[model samples]
Target chain A: MYNKQYLNFLSGLILLFLSHSLMANVITIEITGTPFNPIKIAVVPFQWQGQNLPPAEIASIITSDLYRSGRFNPIKETELTSKPVKGSEIVFADWEKLDVDYVVVGQLNQRNSKYEIRFELFDVFRGEQLSGYNIPSRTKQLRNNAHVISDIIYEKITGQKGDFATQVAYVTAIKKQKQLQYSLHIADSDGYNAQQIVISDEPLLSPAWSPDASKIAYVSYEDHRPLVYIQETATGKKKKVISFFKGINGAPAWSPDGKKLALTLSQGDNPDIYIIDLANNSRTRLTKSFAIDTEPAWSPDGRFIIFTSDRGGKPQLYRVPSIGGRIQRLTFDGEYNARASYSPNGQNIVMVRGEGGKFQIAVLDLGTGFLRILTPGNLDESPSFSPNGNMIIYATENQGKGILAAVSLDGSVHQRLKLQQGSVREPVWAPYGRSR
Target chain B: MNQIKLLSTGLCVLVLSGCGLFGEKVEETDITEETTQTQQQTTPSQETTQPTGQQVQPQTNNVTTNNNGNTGQQSNNAVTQGLGNRPNTQLNEIKEPITPPTERTIYFDFDKSLVRSDMQNILAKHALYLSENPRATIVLEGHADERGTREYNLALGERRARAVKQVLILQGAYADQIEMVSYGEEKPVSLSHDDESWALNRRVEFVYQGQ
Candidate 1:
């Protein structure tokens, strides 16, 4: 009887431990509208006169790039009879039978001492050429050229710009353990050729690109505390801009002119908005509130700034003059709203708002008091508007992992980047001609 | 012997009488101060009776200590304990025992911090709790939400933790405390985001670390 009792107690202990472990690893998913299926695409292998290439196969590169956009389903080589030849006598019916929406065909040719390539995008359903371009290349420029072509086709079909040619600056976990091995990564937007921009055993966050795209500013924990540093993108040389504040002194937003930055500081009792003049190294306080005042965003005109403040009994969007003066409330519909950005046209403010037990991206027309919701889910954050304000990119949780997603301004078209390993987040769409 | 016993008894009576007459008022005053202390704890609650600011009363220390592990509201009987049976007044004051408002902002790393899967449920709870308390205000304190320098990290933390606050608000947290502040590198839990500690450090904490 004693042995049986002991055995029962041991089993109970094991069950308790198992349940605890299971509960600790609970996976929470916050998926909004149905994830858009990739548009069926076939990027047949490019016929090249060269042997094995040092870089990845071009077709796979294009395929994965399209796949990561969460907008293309590439047909495997085994699933097709023959590949399309670039600039050759074409047949659209062969691709149409494969149920492909768009087909990308490319040919690599060697001339003189240099390499050149031509590619074309075809709308199989309409049976017409969608877009095509040729790149007169240098030996080292093949990958970049491929990305540019991908961007062109992506933009043509979606009627929205493509980020394929852009770079993603993110923090990646270094090891399997829980130490602070944070490596700042700059990779092709599709998560390839991931090169470490900055590697430190310190925590880093909030990477902001200079308007010139030549340098980046981010927060780092190198000195055992939060410190902001700026580094040149091309050369990794860094200069510390601010450090050693008594309280919170972070959250930096570079002005469009790249001359000044707006951020939050808590040197006093509570956090408030402040701007720093880069040329003079002087700082000015923009807001003084007893409640939390942070998350500053500049309007395109640079006339005003929007930020999250709890002064109105809750966190809501408040606009203050960029030069610093009075304040006005912009959003009042929801009890909670923060992280607001001005649309490129300066007509609407995009922000995150909570209502009906769900959080969604909301657009508030600055001229009118109209508020419209864009995405619905348990969690959707970091709503960054495209330079044109036609689309919004954000980070959201799906299937227990973080994924970068984009939605059209009209809230109709949607897409997600399918990262194979870790999660992706904090997407800032580059202005036109800035990405390449 | 009888006379000595009587004299000794008289001396004791005189000392005892002097003590009562001289010390009684001071003791009474001490009793009155305790009563006032108790009243201060109870009356302010009545004046500010909002649910979020529900009066904790004088006996909160006892209840807090007992319920620290439980994280649940204690019985009303515990509320009547005044100052007895519990120690540590400062602990109760430090803790944000009240349920936070909707849209609490958790913070994150500087350039590379990733949200460990551990924080999603805490955020979900905050979202659900915020949705339940509609009028309750919240500010998602997104420090780097402090990692980078004061300016850019401010933008980055604002973008990062504000992203978390945005998520909570989207999940149903009131846009209130759901507000975000990027301390950038101004505030850090651990001074690193290297392997384990830095990863822990490079995150937006769901702080009721409210001022």
Candidate 2:
């Protein structure tokens, strides 16, 4: 759905989101569509030319990445009649009999302490090699390199940018007897290589990545009140953005330029939206309603900001100018809509739609005013767009537990990354690059 | 790969008694206002029609004498004799027989900030206890169920707590004596996913600081 130029330009604004609180909630999945005509692909196990083996299962990683995208269904490793290391070895008749449309073949070898990874994508029907890469890498970079391979093969076939190389940050919690342990974690998009960023006895929510991917801004209750804190991803150091306030101080959204944050501060017995300029420590109040006005997200273009407010009775999505002006209602299809944000293209808004207490992720096209409900689950929230505007990641509750789930924009592809023991929610997909 | 262990930052209990701002220690809030004029105007709740307001707060010396643990103390509870039963400062100290209500929690409906009507009596009882004991401070831990988004739930939790706080202040409790912190949907009393469990988790808890 996104091009390379757009992905490169959109790399900075990967919408950083949250993980499920450590509830250990297993993913509740319905196992929906497969893109109508699913692409049948085969990634043969890579040939190892070095002693022992490479740190990663390169072929399996690429296979899993494509399958997770819900676009390609890679054949099982057991189904491969012959393992091919190059284009000439691939027997097109064998793949045609098996009905695989595309094939990925690769070899890995140690060259002067650097792992040389070579791979080629082939259109089995045309019997032509579509793409190939000869890359030089190191030991630790192998896993990431596998994802890099996945991106190339995925893009070659789907004609869209791949998000496998991107990172995701979410908050997870594990209960230790009488105490609830909370920790913020960042992991690969596939729910692997998770690294904990911060831990507190209190709750942490709404993690926003800096445009540069160097820092994350989240709300923590460690000080016994919800206050916004910006933490350096490289360091555990953090400082409260606001000195102290009498009431609620939560919901932090970084501006596209990263110089400002639109926040929700409850001062006069009600919550309202305020923009804080980081340079001079100045604050701009956007919405001054007695109703609950919260969950502020700036548009990708930074021209406007969308928020959830109950000024219209039930909570609904409202759009206002970024500099503060006349407000307009965006969604009337649902009785309850909140935690809304813009797609990287700024043409659509993803939000949590609730009616009759059953909530799920929904998307509203900015041009047509048509609301398309994505997830079918009753309890789903915190919908965030991948930087390329291809997939939307959110948290959903299954059975009695919380887990992370993602659905493509067209509601065709659904993937659940509930591999962790505890439940995870509030998953925000990182943009094009790695997190610092 | 540079994963820093934050146990030390969380273990700041050794350095700072309370988790105030980051290196910004907050002085104890000043909640002692001794004027008692608008008792009739504020909090015209159905359960507690007559609120004595500041006049009901007992003095420091008499508060020490009333142990309030006696089984007989339950007989003079908040609804009956405790609701403006002993008026003014003189009788408040001697007749302040109502022990702090054992039930300290008040639950709210889904996404609702207003405390339920049935829970009003519990808050009234707690307000009466606060009115009688001005020296004692309680922190209201606001919480929401794990149904909604975290940040929105955080805001909702605070609204529920502040709703109770406003009621307490209107009834008789000093504003400064009650502190609030919303855990949002982060901390759940019930881990189950059904309505009963979510109902149990959405509440405000009365946590008295120090003995």
Candidate 3:
């Protein structure tokens, strides 16, 4: 009896140790959407004329990107009656019979180290090419060329710029034994090819991308204190931009022009919003209130700085001039609304709204003052708008582990991105530009 | 063995008399010394409070010898005995534990920073200890429940820390002795999403330096 009890206790200890070491691996993105009359389109598989197969399938990538947008329903390649590599080789009658409104056809040719990618968007009804582009890129740039092609096709069809070519930065945390490992990662907007920009044994939070998408600023607690650091995305080189502050050096948001960063500092009695000029590290205090004020996001035009403040009791969104002037309260609908970022066009603002003890993502129309809740999850935060203002990516919890999630502005499309083992959070969508 | 018994009996008598004399001296001296001595007394007494089975036999013998010798110190013995015997009981009743820093975690209500009545005595104990130990320093790590945005929570955590700092400074702790850092909701002791877990997460943890 004594031996059995001892064995049971030993097994219990082993199980406990095993459970603590378990962690998720690479993140897998799960896309779910309720299509609301999605437009019918066909993306023909691009013919590869290279000796080595291109790194990634160009047509398939474009098809997945369009389908995930919740605006287009690309027919499967197996369902295609004929595959056309160019507009002149298209059979418009077959597509018309298939009820397809648009078709994308492309071909990839390799000339030594350079790749010649040609793609065209065709009007299936008119039997004519609506748009065509010949993009010349290196072998390694094939995937990016695919995204750019997807963007062009999306723009030609929807009249809105596509965010496929953009990237996202987020923080991932994994518990190993008694230590917590944190990594800041930058990946394509589709959550592929993630590269760790910074990794530490301590916690990392609040990653903010620069407007040009070349640099990222985030808070690191490696020294057991919160300090802001900016890193070049392409080179993975970082510098401690703001440290040695008495209290917090957090919430770093790059201005629209990328020359200045608006952040929250608490060297004084209370936390307040402050903008630091990147050139000289000179700071200009924006809010002068005893209440907590933080999460400063700049307007697209760089005219106003919107932030979250609890000056009026509960935390709400507030706006002030970039150069420090009158402060105006911007949100009044909810008891808790914060972490707001502007859409690329500056017509709407997406923020995390808390009501009935559940926090979710919501968008407030600036012109109409209409608030629309975009997510159904209970604990959603860090809402960042895609560069083209078509989708909002945020962090949400699943089974007590943090996960990255994105929702279309209209709330029609939803995608959950999660690592196989660990937790990821604080996703910031990079702006549209040619950076990597 | 007879001599040991007699010495213990005599030590108890000395402790009782010492308590009487030391209580009077505490009233005469300033607040810092009184609290500092009280905290110094607590360290040895806490060791004795632990289960005797877990204590090494030699260590316990050493403690007994130290106690016998300390009893001969008169007023200091009285203060030490008073603190060791009762811990923070009297201080809790008085709501001013000008004795020692015993509490480490200061909890707050959801989205609120006003230190609750139950936590006042604990904060008072910390304040008294800090006020007494001039060279001693502490870091107040403030945290918040995972209900709001990250940046806003960061500010909230700082507010809670500042609230604790204000209480400590008001109670005589040196302004420079306490450093505050807010971790917001990034680090949580409890990972559960329920109210109980959140209450545990929203707290100010007092970490002493050179421990």
Candidate 4:
């Protein structure tokens, strides 16, 4: 009888150990990474309804896009016993057995030199297509169309809007001894279909997109010095919009209304805060200190501008009225804080802060003043919020090479968007979200 | 004479005991000689001194001067921290022998405007020299980085001259000489983002033009 009692106790202890181990693994997978909730998505390959293959690879592109987002688990084609190529052919039993919650299917057709892409979103359990659309496209617009489809699927499944159709403006450098080649490129946020909008053998830095996403303003070395240029997005055409005065021409921040810009200028002897009107082209100086001031960002309401200044000794964030009034300092914890971007909600600000000689992205609550570092990388900078403010894109170094990276606003997940070849730097997130 | 002789005898005894002091002095001399020889043997080509924090100060300045033209170029990696939004201001301090002025004079047009082509040459030279020197830093004071809104012109003025600097480095300038700083027509070289004033105001000038 005593022997039977001891055996029972041992069996209970063994069962507890196994259960504890399984639970720990599950908790670590979700807790350590992004806000990923283990979403199950069925990505059916796009079928070409046209006689010839489309100019773009639609399914591969969408697969790459969703996979890179870190929010979904796209089922693999090899794992399935059978696959469906179109919405009409889908078998819900096959998807259900694979434990997929959502299914995507699409077809491509070309007519009269224009392409039409039809895609459908479906709920696996309901066995019904949830949403479907047919959109016109051009050969040049195929990849962009794929981005749009991905955006739609993402919003429908995640309940948050997507920014896949947005344009990312960045600088690329090719250096050979004393010669440096700099090009300003605008492309899909995934770094596809990138076209060189402005190419200078000089240094190009700081590319800012307009609120309407129709234009890009950037610093170029065309005149052998740092000058600002505005370029139309549709055409590569450009004009010198601003030039030298004093100190340095750096850090251009556009207002929410697309009417004015907040920039750093040293023409007044010190790099101070200033505002310029795009209509009459006039100036109103806001700051009068001798400290180094730069990197301005506007609130969504367009009433205030946040900027970086060393007035308090180290670089910190400060806010001033857009109409030129009293300035209030915002950040105080770290010795250095600069390059701040406002979230879509305008309740928080994302910026690069230095701690222990390394730089990382940090979000500051405008309401509570709570600051939290977002990334662990040493050189993260230029944090830009997504349209919904759920994700942030910034510049960081990987293995000593400069590339753009994205992370969840809550610091739960990390993803990298690197160039297939060469070096890429300076990523500017689009304001109007992605293109249609 | 007997008392004097007794006192002199006592003094001799005292003097004899002082011989221990001489022996100690000899020992110290032997140690000094040995140390000097060991130092000479170890460092026969140059004199040596214990290096402290103060010793590095003058050497650091000398090394910086020796690298005068290249020091700024070497630190170009620092600007990588800008990732995408930060400006490459480190290039400005590379080769600039002259001190930058607190203010600059950018020219503009009246009523009708654009960044004049003539200004390109000056801006190019500033960018080229600044980037090459990497240490000769200058701020491209943008009267407009553009001239749309107060905020828009702020971005425009910064863009106008930065566009120039981008071109300059392409023409073989260093990243050092030119910094993109927009005054947004506030301290207008011509006081406008207007066609005329905008033309002039939409300019960036070297802070230390003459220098």
* TM-score of each model's chain B: 0.43, 0.54, 0.54, 0.39
lDDT of 4 at A227: 63
Name model 4 segments beyond 4 Å from true: A1-35, A49-54, A109-115, A433-436, B1-211
Cα lDDT tens digits, model 3, A98-173, are 9999999989888887889999999988888989999998855776778888888888888988889889999988
Best by lDDT: 3
- Quick one: best TM-score, which candidate? 3
Best-to-worst order by DockQ is 3, 2, 1, 4
lDDT for each residue of candidate 4 in A1-436, tens digit (9 for 90 to 100): 9999999988886676566434323211111353457578877777786643456667767765666566776777677666566777888898888898988888788787788888888999998878889989887788888988888888888888877777778877665455657788876767666778888776677788889888888876567555667788787788765564744565677788888777766663456767878787688888888666677888999988888876886678899988878889999898778878799889999988877757788999989979989899876776788777777888776664567787777676677766644456668888763254
The regions of model 1 sitting more than 4 angstroms off are A1-45, A52-83, A92-104, A109-116, A121-131, A136-141, A154-162, A173-178, A355-377, A386-391, A398-403, A406-427, A430-436, B1-211
> What DockQ values do the models have?
0.05, 0.36, 0.53, 0.03
Model 2 chain B poorest 10 in a row by lDDT: B64-73
Q: For model 2, how does the per-residue alpha-carbon lDDT over A265-304 read when each residue is reduced to its tens digit?
A: 8863688999999898799999998788899999988989
Compute fnat per model.
0.07, 0.56, 0.81, 0.06
Interface DockQ of candidate 3:
0.53
Q: Output the lDDT of residue A191, model 3.
A: 75
Could you give the C-alpha RMSD of every candidate to the true structure, in order shown? 20.6, 18.7, 14.0, 25.6
TM-score for every candidate vs. truth?
0.56, 0.77, 0.78, 0.61
What i-RMS does every model get? Answer: 9.2, 1.6, 1.1, 12.9
Off by over 4 Å in 3: A1-25, A35-37, A47-55, A77-79, A85-89, A107-118, A132-140, B1-102
Pairwise lDDT winner, candidates 2 and 3: 3
Worst 10 residues of 4 chain A by lDDT: A23-32
Evaluation by lDDT, superior candidate among 1 and 3: 3
